[model samples]
Target: MSEHHTLYAAFAERIDAVLSALELEGALPPGTSRANVSVEPPRDPSHGDLATNAAMVLAKPAATNPRSLAEKIVEHLSRDPLIESAQIAGPGFINLRLARSTWTDELAAIAALGGDYGKSAMGEGRRVNIEYVSANPTGPMHMGHCRGAVVGDALASLLEFAGHAVTREYYVNDAGGQVDTLARSVHLRYREALGEDVGAIPDGFYPGAYLVPVGEAAAQEFGDRYRSAPEAEWLPVFRAFAVERMMAIIRADLQLLGIAHDVFSSEAALQAAGKPEAAEAWLRAHDLVYDGVLEAPKGKEPPDDWEATELPLFRSTRFGDDQDRPIRKSDGKWTYFGADLAYHMQKAESADELIDIWGADHAGTVKRIKAAVAALSEGQGEPIPFDVKLVQMVQLLRNGEPAKMSKRSGNFVTIADMVDEVGKDVVRFSMLTRKPEAQMDFDFAKVVEESKDNPVFYVQYAHARIRSILRKGADENFAPSAEHLGLLGEDDLALVKRAAQFPREVEMAARTREPHRIAFYLADLAAELHAFWNLGNADQQKRFIVAQDANLSGARLFLAAQIGQVIRNGLALLGVEAVEEL
Candidate 1:
């Protein structure tokens, strides 16, 4: 009942104690690092309940063969009452089978912990700032941005559950040429709203009909004041209004998928505060920035028109980049890289670690930004940890054909549209069914199917089935009781063992910074639950509610309830709902 108490953690400590005793006995060298030793579930469940490579990893350090070390470790491990058996497998791997009471005790722990079952203290309350879905303020949220958004949001929740202070951030790229185009697009809509015959939307302007509402609002607010004005007179005013409206649309779309960021950092605001100038000055002082000219293009046939122009460049080549990167353009305006460098420098000021979830198209720019962060942070005497995760694009399909574009957004399918067709839970869970960096297809037909092939449906059905059984037991005047848990058999204990893996899976996913692993784990756990449920179909006695045996029924229901709790805990980390009825 202590904080962060888990079955796997307990066994891990036991293994460490055994190793420490060997160190004291001079069986292993003193001060040897045990960092590489790992205790996890074996690949084949039939081998044992828990497997460790302790002997395999420590054999060389102890001046012994793996089999010798394995035998010694097993001799000590066999003495523990909780271990039913300790056997050495191929290549000196030691697998331990736990007493039936161990799984029963873990089930009790799950019930006691409830929603907090899988939470961990691995992060130790470190501050982590995660920036994601920083789509341009020029349009609505689309399928292109969906994958990174879900990945980043789920990772933030996962880290928080692992005991980190997390800040979910969205960077607004408002100070860019794209917003100018958006402003012009809204102007056409504004004129159309005022009964002006604004012909076809120009090729360079945003052609989405979504901007009509923003145009209508502008018309109502200004009342023809900027209708006939020159380009300069109305560009800035309309740009600000359009950017604000676009951000509102983006937020609403994100809300459809159950996503909300804690902070929305503005690129314009960062530039207005002169952070870029400050960053340049600091880099210059450290000789990390110098006046330089870049080489011509890298291909076999370089551009004949390529010319060298002197500009302020970051010494990215010094930090593993292929070449020095320009921070500003020939016109004295800051390039995207320049603004991003300053943005990351500012983020490092408040966070112990920083993470950016970007689309795979941005992969080429990652090295330069990493170099900038390393140079800037190290120059300040404290280097902050930074990670950039690139998520591949999701191709939307309908009946094996490419999905149609949204009339509302004009170019791509909007997130809202996707969520409307298939509910938010389906979209969120589907996005996470695959690794973030691997390309995936969001087939509308396959995702919404109710069959077991759909992972979301399969996982949700497991929780619903358990809830239904509990409800039926309630109607028959039966309640779950832990007092008779000893009556549960091996099949019941196997399910309990699978459920106990939730805490370990949570820590592993958090450590790898991969939330999709949680989805994979949940799918496996659901399969285990379904397999257990099938036992009742084969035999009447294996059913959860036995007509004449209240003690056995109560124990079964107790086990079922804890399994449901574990599923709910896992789904909560992925921000997916655990529906009682699906």
Candidate 2:
């Protein structure tokens, strides 16, 4: 792979070198921490191309005033051929204006690197296990799981682009009561398949017609053997069969949205292997677990049936949980927390880092699970970085009102149905238009609208328009050439500057674990491209294709091609298609 040196990264190195030279010259103290020094675009673009706080950050440690230090730094910085000028702004900040050749060189780099333009090495190949859309294997995926699914998948891609070895995973909750209920529901359908009336699905049972096929499949394979057996004999058989069939359905739904997990861990299988028991034994030896009685429930109206019972408890409160949590119930079965802790420990064994994407309803459980991982890390003598990102619910709407539910999933709109209606690109991109912690509405009518108001459309349209311009140039016998790139002026470099931000944006987004930043950046870049294209409307000489001047037109075409490549690269990270034509 070719190494990509982004404009921002290149300049950051230059600033660091300048600082190092200052230290050697005895103008500053030795071994001063540069951790806080940063290079970024000036908030006001009119100030300069790039801004850094190296002087301000190092001033106190060097025993000098910031302005005095900045002047010394700028003296060395001004000597670099790539730097046109360096000036000290307000107390200590340094702003730099790059030589025009610098941007032209970056544009040349963009052309040479093509799709690899914004790729970074920030992650340095660490293994990251990201679990998302682990909705119970109960039914088809619904809108409730849609946001986190897209967010997690996009983050995984962003990390990979930033040079991380990422594993996409899904946790199957097949051991819980939900799967047991699913088994009972499928049993009713099995009876119906075997010619029983099986009237309306009773309360507490799944009512979706999607399970009818699972029941028919079961009836075909098992005949009438377990059909008439006791609940004990049939529950296990039906549960396994139902879970397998439901997982197939979930996989199909995820595939429709361009998502596939590298691993699907089963809770039942984890229990069968006694992983939870091993986790409990280790925690007990480490004093992280003990036998205790939990206090009665605390509330404005406490439960009348609340009772205290001795159980194996985890010392979660020591790590910031409101109270210690129970690892097992009075009946000897592991509680959900016990199983989840074991699952995370299993994940930590192989991965350098762990991330879980869950719904907002799971927010209350975050602290305990984090405490478990912290305890496990303490026992192993190595810290395991764990983060749980909660995605707020998305309300599905048609036009302006709440959308109708799918008959297939019973109460919620299935992911398959949404993708079928709007498209995979629209569904995936719409899910990431807002921050995951903030609630959002997915309006069917608004998302599919073909206008600037729709972000996906706006960005895709930009790529499409660039292709159209290239095609027109080809038809007019004009080929894009870097030979006359010097013919391009300031208005054109503004677009180059916007496109150049992609690498910096990618690194920042990956560091923050927010893929939406890529989407936001692409939207702004598209706006810049569109604005630049509009300049041709008022003045014939400003148009991308100047019939009288092929050299200028060729240079402009080359610029447009590189901008299109950036749009494609950003959309690829979000898993959205960049259409060549509308």
Estimate, for each residue in 1-582, the C-alpha lDDT of model 1 and write its tens digit: 246566877998999999999989889998899999988899998999999999998999899999999998999999999999999999999999999889888888888889999899989999999999999998889999999999999999999999899999999999999989999999899999999999888789888889999999999988999999999999999989999999999999999989999999999999999999999999999999999888878898768887888999999988888889999998999999999999999999989999999999999999989989988889777788899999999999998999999989888999999999998989999999999989999999999888999999999999999999999999999899999999998888889988888898888899999999999999999999998889999987888988899999999999999999999999998899999987
The residue-by-residue lDDT of candidate 2 on 263-331, one tens digit each, is 999999999999999999999998999999997787786587877789999998898888999999998
**Could you tell me how far off, in angstroms, the CA of residue 514 lies in candidate 1 after the best superposition?**
0.2
lDDT (Cα) of model 2: 0.93
Query: Residue 60 lDDT in model 2?
Result: 97
Every candidate's lDDT: 0.93, 0.93
Q: Could you say which candidate leads in lDDT? A: 2
Model 1 error, position 30 (Å): 3.4
Q: Candidate 1: misplaced stretches above 4 Å?
A: 298-305
C-alpha RMSD in Å of predicted model 2 compared with the true structure: 1.1
Clashing pairs in 2: none
